[model samples]
Target: MNDPYDNCMAACDACAHAYDACTAAYLAERDAQALADCIALDIECAQLCRFASGAMARRSVLTPSVCALCAQACDLCAAECQRHAHDHCRRCALACEACAAMCRAVA
Candidate 1:
């Protein structure tokens, strides 16, 4: 009942929110400096996810290319988040992994 693009868009939107939340949580950590890469990747992944979702929503011709990039961002973010041991990081990693899978399929 759902289109692949629609599903991918939804996943991307969710992952963006997750990444944003993780970034905020990490910023409040005592060793935030150690999470610099994770935070950076979170921001990058969120931005890409938002862009990919927008492109898919409008059925843009470049959706596939955007999705491919989004997938890479999501994967890198997931890997970074997985290096941490916080609940927020775990949640974000899961979301990123799911979004990456969807992006790969959509691409």
Candidate 2:
């Protein structure tokens, strides 16, 4: 069955993955000290996206609220990622932007 929130859930999941991958890329080779804010935001955004996805999957009452926050987090992550020149960051930014739009639709 196709759930009404399936698209939002997928977007949230993909956003979380993108943020995680971006963070991993930063930790692996990027200068952690210089990009500390980006790293922190990525972690927060990833967690929020995951939580939002779970809420939707479970059909929680707080899904709207969770998705709203997740959208904000995605926006923040996208802005931070856009500030960087790395390929991972660029990709993550795109993912984040897409996720935010999906989340807003549900919110």
Candidate 3:
């Protein structure tokens, strides 16, 4: 059977990928300067998600704390992404929302 953390880990992975893609897309936009905060949050969220996923995979004692921080990062990233109307941003927001919920559930 799959571990309980599997779903959350997968969600984190998805969120990280989405954030990376969204960040890259924002950098390519004409108003890249306008997305500075969004880009920075995306980077932070992605890194946190990666670390949380690894912690969960390893069944580390710090998984819960890591997940708590990951959830916060995802929430902030989602809010930032939601401020933009771009397709990539919208998709990233959705992923971040899902990931945040999953992280909260495990945390």
The C-alpha RMSD of each candidate to the native structure, in angstroms, is 1.0, 1.1, 0.7
Q: Between which residue pairs do clashes occur in model 2?
A: none
**If scored against the real structure, what TM-score would every candidate get?**
0.94, 0.95, 0.97
| lDDT (10s digit) by residue, model 2, range 1-107 | 88889999998999889999998889887468888888999999999999999999899999999999999989988988998899999999999999999999999
Clashes of each: 0, 0, 0
Highest TM-score against the true fold, candidate: 3
lDDT at residue 49 of model 2 (Cα atoms): 94
lDDT of each: 0.91, 0.92, 0.94
Window of ten residues with lowest summed lDDT in model 2: 27-36
Q: Specify the poorest-scoring 10-residue window by lDDT in model 1.
A: 76-85
Q: List the residue pairs that clash in candidate 3.
A: none
Residue 82, model 3, lDDT: 87
Give the lDDT of residue 67 in candidate 2.
Answer: 92
Instruction: Give the CA lDDT, 0 to 100, for residue 11 in model 1.
Output: 91
TM-score pick, better of 1 and 2: 2
lDDT, candidate 2, equals 0.92
Regions more than 4 Å wrong, model 2: none
lDDT of 1 by residue, 18-86 (tens): 998999998998998987878888888899999999999889999999999999988888888888788
